[model samples]
Target: MHYCPYCGSLVIEEEKYCMKCGKELPSDFDERVTSSKSKWKWWKYPIIISLVIALFITVLFVRTQQQENDAQELYQQAEEMALIGDYQTSKEYIEQALDHKNNFPTAKAVLDFLKIAIESKNTINDIDALAKNQNYEEALDKLTAIENNISGFKGDLINKLNTTVSDYRNNILYQQAEHKLTNDLSKDELKELLWEVEEITDEKAEVIKEAIQEKIVAHTSNHATELLKENQFNQAMLVVEDGLIYAEESEQLQSLKTTVEKEKIAFETAQEERIEQALTIYEQEDEINRNQAVEVLNVNASVSTNEITVTGEIKSVATVPINSILVSYQLKNNDTQILENDVYVFPETLYPDEKGKFEFTHFNKEIKNNDLTAEVTKITWFID
Candidate 1:
């Protein structure tokens, strides 16, 4: 294909204008890419069996028997050329048949499919070259562009194009799967790649899909196992949940889920016991007051180009010593529209009538607006 000299957009030699940039193509650009692909290779030849064409001819000849005309002869000649893998000659014959009989519907349909057949044959050649060089992205792009328009093709032509599309798509996916698996992409990225492979609906997709399934299940289970050891049960569960979406019946992933659930229940039970014991001690010391005893005070916010810094003072009026305080806040715009809700750990303990300060910086280089103010929503504390 020729490229637009002005914009470098790809354009076929037959195109008068660039599809991407709409620029007039230079005449010299057509000289390089207009070489005729006149014959299909022996292995790729014979897309439609001769028996089917014979049957089609028998039916068409009966319909045109009364005319005994030039159009009928030209149409038969086109089918003969097509059967021998001469797509360009066959398309020319079909076009001649149409010129002889402008009102012939059967000839019109044959011309449409003939054009698609020629295009499909040429496309497969280009895809072969691109695939040989491992240029899968461009190959896939070319296939997609052809597919969007070939839906109107009829008869053996559609079957030929479909086979071409399916074979190349699976080939590309299989190679891509092997190449990408050697890289260091995250599980989600790998999963996305395999999900495309899983769509082939043919045995070609299954081979690589099975390998990807094992990798994802094992990788996710190992990650969740590590998180469980660190007492991060919730995050571990999320990881296992993601893995199960790709391999729902995986024993490793299911076992990981069971282990995470048991761990979470045990941890929450222990946490409740600790809180109960601490509350009892505070009550015995006549220092327990259970009615929302933590307050956020002197909250201030500052905005910069890359950051929104929120500093706040917190006082504990609870009956017991509180540590690991959690603060939830919202950032709102000037119109009182909330933009984000987040939490910050106060990082210190506070006893009754004691105060502590916290500073949280949120916005990043990717953040578009840092002109938001902070709104404290909820505060909670726990004993050591």
Candidate 2:
């Protein structure tokens, strides 16, 4: 038997080459093959060791790349979640990324940022809860604190929270105003409530203010109308005036005030004219004699701090006895404006040429040195 020198394969002694490895045998085949095998054994160990080390390096590189890819994917997921305001879930993803690559700098920074974001999200949620619970002042305080402290924090979440707080506050104010309106508040109280309602800068705030204004105007108008019916013109004007302070542009109240003023002027003018006509009739001697009425004489007026008193004498000039006689008197100011007018009645019968005493008293503070006039407005004769 022989072995090829180049390859460790057995062959017949007559063969020139080994068929298995296709290597030719050397002369002095056994010694050459032995020397060749021994020399190549050390070379095979080095090549095998080199091949094993290269395979290990390649596997390690592939695994490291896969881990890096996983970490990057987690970071991207964290970023997406953070964009959607899911800070808690984003923080979890970022922490997982850090786990994959413990020393990743970008992941570290993102984790820090996510931590802040989570805190802000939690704070906003707490504020929402507080507002829902109607603890609006506290919620506002917390929100303001966050706004003052956190720079560049005006994102969608913060904006939404601010709007929510604002709406809630306005809603509270509107409800309070509505409640106040339900009560029978005075015009001044309603005015103050309107002021408060106007301070609310919400969409519904205008509606609330308009409703309050309507209530004020309606109430004032109705009250003034009642007063006008009772001839309390001064008090009615005061009510309308107060209502105008709340509803400055209310046409209803303005019209009511104008009507009151006009009626008051007409009433005063008519009274003055009636008094003047009564005085004219009394002054005409033929008219008095034709009517066979009473004559007013010895008229005098006395004034005091709070009142004016007018005393006069009336003589029945009728042919027969009169059962009743009535005298009307007018108190005039310096401008000839009638301050007051009243009638004095004598119920007892007065025969011809019989005299009767009449007096008129009024609480008129403005009754100064002015003319006084009296006339017999009525005479009743007894039927025989």
Candidate 3:
């Protein structure tokens, strides 16, 4: 195969100018190609058709031998180009070798390999830029893509390319993981890096893995402790679980897990006792309020997009008129108590067999209380 004198890019024998550089080719260059291929003289062709026919079989054999030699020589040139990392030129040479002898398995393998090699080199360069920017995940994804692209083709360049790619991938993983693990990262971020490097069994990777494990234990333990202090038992337990995932055998994490469980149980027990005491007090107050001969009745509540309205009537069951009344109420949402407050019914007075109406409304964008209830807890009144 011919190449451009100016640019070293592929060119054809018949072209007067280089396609890549647009420079005029040497005129003798065309003459050399012509002289090489045209061995039959025009004057000799006029000798006899009979003589030409007689020599056809012998000439055909010699020309086939010469073509085979040319094919082998071109294949050698392709191999040399590949060795020097000029993959584009290597591919061109091997392709021309195949054109000289299309069925050459060795040349075909080299050509396929060169194409993949060139592509991988370009992709690796892009990965370098990405790694420089600390775009580690994207670089890792590209590494996977290149490995998959190799597709197990057989060639002399295959083992060399595989080794190069594998080394590059490992270096990327190691350097990035080391940098991240050495710095402060969230539990989730460290876990991601740990998972990425799990496939690497080398000693440098192990050091990184160890750093990640230590960080998980320390960071997660502290995080969980803060959550536990805030009385967020479930959230604390989740943080503990996150630590345990990376360092299942870590004594710190295991002890922390046990502490979380014990504290959660203890907290639950204390809460249960508090709730029980509160309920007992509520029931006693409710009984006392019921005996006082005042009762809440005809309670109705409605909710709008921005407001919750509760309106109810209060009745006096006593034999006398009552005035200056204030009632304590429990506000509930979805059967769970939310708040408590005191309100005075309108008119502040109810005669025997008479009633007073009360209403409460709250407007807040954040409260989506679709199922709200207002229940009376305590009532104070003066008999008149």
Candidate 4:
């Protein structure tokens, strides 16, 4: 790679002149070309063919030298035009110089500066046109394009443009909400939109919230108006209460409440119509279901030991699946006659089937005789 002598940009060696700067060929260039072709000169060819090749090489070399001269002349002209601030003319000449050698690095640098200047001018014009038409959306778009294209604009200008766009968007949302609130939509729909408005920020959200509150008050006030026209004082009071809930601390809510109270005195005497009655009817329906439960009975009296074990199969009215049944027995004296005992027994929440076994030990030490009887009060099933 070779750099442009004028602007210090990279250029390819194949070029005859600087594509960017339009600079002339270097004066001591015979040494550079001879060095390039010296490697292949040793191969021999016919004299006529050699002469024709020599003529073609000479023509090619002259054309390359002429192009270098033309590019240098164009560079001088472009520079003068730019110095006088005739950028449009300068841009055209620079383009023509680049056509001779696209790898001119000097011309590319100047083109970069000119392109930025042109873009800035066009952006300002677009912004002006959009502002005149009150097309805020398009104005924002133009400002953003300028910001992306140019790098050296003043900071304050960018900040001002951003503020303008933010305000425009917020105002658009506020106005949309105002229009919706004014229409006769249901309260549920209005409340839902009100929540969305709160999600918006800055001036727009505040404005919309105020508008929604006003609509709520006005709609509730309509209820008051209807109640007065029909002379339904109690129903009107309910409507005023509902309005108070919707409006909260609004002036509309206060005035509505006062107006209903003022009409309360005269409206009180007009409510005296009553219809009262009481009626009763007794009806019965009967249903029967098969009832099944386990029963455990102890069959021996006067067992010889203080400890006695009772074992029995529980009988059920239907095919009884015998499960583990709780046998609760209190040893009583043989002389004590057995009567129907109502004992509260804790039944297992689940039913279990097994050989149910429960042992009753007589704990009282005073009974000298070993005569003992066991009684079954309740039976319950537990599953393991």
Candidate 5:
């Protein structure tokens, strides 16, 4: 038997060419032949199995990730519902999806939203209870709070609140008007008149919030006036501020604010002037006392045609031990200052037991107004 090396087939021994490959083999073909057995290692089967296992793991991991994403989407929807006050249904949805998902952010968010919603619901209930008992301020405060706390309120509720506020404001106005109308009308007759006016005014106020202009402004302005009368200018200003919030651009309110500001300025100016006048009087009195307390070293100076001399003495009894003191005298035009003199007492120390005198001579200039005044400055005392 013979085999063709190219095609690996058997042939007759006498054949010169291979029957399967149609190629001629050399007579020494055995020397050139090598083994045709498979060279694949045995561990290749394990490598193939590992590739298959890795593909299976990859598919499973992707499926788990998809499921987790779906769960997170459901939890987000549940939280949004809870925030809008749909707690029961939101809780139901979250609980249903909780088992399928781990690390659910919306689960915690939903719980927190539900807690806030429930608390707000309780607060509204409390307000309702108070409102039933006619505790209007507390009820109104809570209603305003609910408006702030809730993200959105129904249009119906908002309209209802508007009507309620209108009614409350009109009721207050009617009561005030009734107090002012001191006529002897029958109770039914007076009540009917005020009721009709309130209905018309409230209807107008619904269309225009500033329709209650006179009442809102007059009330606040009157209060401000009372404050001004009581000399409480700061409080009066606060009253005007509160009034303007309701009737912000009302001409009446503006006028009232202007009036209050003017009054406040006038009051402040008068107070300042009074204080200044008192200080001036006190300074004059202090100067008089100082001059009287000083020891008279000399009085009455000789006046020549060209010069005049004046002498003064300072006693140490009421003065600190000062090295020197300065005295200033002034000359004035009608109401304006024209000239001044600063006379320094120099080279002398005034102790408590000692006294000192000085003489000053100054030339006189003819002027229309001549008023002489003296004051002291830079009276430094040494710390013993």
Candidate 6:
């Protein structure tokens, strides 16, 4: 008998190689195989069984370690996403990790945290969207809810959200106030809107309020200017008075008021000059013929309760018949100021040396002077 040295398989002595192991045998292989088999016989089967069991345990341990590693990887991914505020995606990864390893404690804990974080994050996102759409009232309500519900939230994120909501609220108010200012609104209505703007605490609110004030001043000044151009001085002053109530420090309104006052003075002066001219033209004797025309005499004034009557007589001093006669007279107060002045015409032919009586009566309530004077200012006659 022989044995192959590589495998210790028994073979016949004539064979060069062992058939079972396909290995060549050495001379004296049987002696060596006999010695080696006796040395291994007591422990071979037990060692083989122990090695198979160790291999099986090693494979199971490796598979378990791999599963744990895979779950840890998923958890790490979830953690990374959570740090950057992507809680929804982080939640998905956390759920996948728990599915991969049902007993993963870290994954289960993170999933619970992620659920709360996702809810809070979604609420904040919804608030931001509402603010972007200029729905500040609704956004504020949502923000208040989030604040009440989520305690110990991220401070920096909450502060940022607060700033966004505040800015959106201010912008909406500013836009509304700006729209009202641009329109043709009354002073009271504009002031009411301006009061709303003044109550806002935003940094830009002051600037917007100033702009609206300027618009108000400009509108008032322009409106007053139009009235001034139309010679409506009293109405223009009223406009300035109303505008000053709103914009007391407005230079435009003040300046416009000054201009209107000057215009009023100039207008009154022109009116007084015109009245003086009319009275002075009648006082001149060059416009009347005192010899050939009828002469006015015996002028007398009588005042009653409701009327004042001025009676006079006119006689043709020339030896010719006058076709038409006119008598211009002026009524003066005790201060010699002309109160009422008019001309009266007789539509009759007066024969030579004929006398005609004339009377002028006026309502006493219409005369605002304390005394009255009747005098012939001018007379006209027809020459044959």
RMSD each, Å: 39.2, 18.5, 28.4, 28.4, 25.2, 20.2
- State how far residue 136 of model 3 sits from its true place (Å): 4.3
Using all chains and alpha carbons, the TM-scores for the candidates as numbered come to 0.50, 0.41, 0.46, 0.26, 0.31, 0.37
- Model 2: weakest 10-residue lDDT segment is 375-384
> Candidate 4 versus the native: TM-score?
0.26
Residue pairs whose backbone atoms clash in candidate 1: 287-319
205-323, model 1: which lDDT tens digit per residue? Answer: 77778878888987898899999999999899999998999999898889879989999999999999999998887676543344466777777777777677878887887767788
lDDT of each: 0.76, 0.72, 0.79, 0.57, 0.58, 0.71
Q: What TM value does model 2 have?
A: 0.41
Candidate 1: regions farther than 4 A off: 1-77, 80-86, 92-105, 269-384
TM-score of 5: 0.31
Candidate number with greatest TM-score: 1
Model 6 agreement with the true structure over 65-86: per-residue lDDT tens digits: 8888888899888877876767
lDDT of 2: 0.72
Residue lDDT tens for model 5, 259-285: 888998998999999999999976775
Which residue pairs clash in candidate 2? none
Can you write out model 3's per-residue Cα lDDT over 150-252, one digit (the tens) per residue? 8677555666677777887888888888777667788788888889888775668878888889887889989999998998888988888878878988998
lDDT of 4 by residue, 9-93 (tens): 4556666676777775354444224321232332334665889999999999998777777776776787777655566787788
Tens digit of per-residue lDDT, candidate 2, span 290-375: 47557766666677777777777878776556664556555555546465455554646677778887777777466445454433
Those runs of model 3 whose alpha carbons end farther than 4 Å from true positions after fitting are 1-106, 133-156, 199-203, 230-235, 264-384
Candidate 6: give the clashing pairs. none
Candidate 2: residue 216 lDDT (0-100): 90
- Which stretches in model 4 have alpha-carbon errors above 4 Å? 1-172, 181-188, 270-384
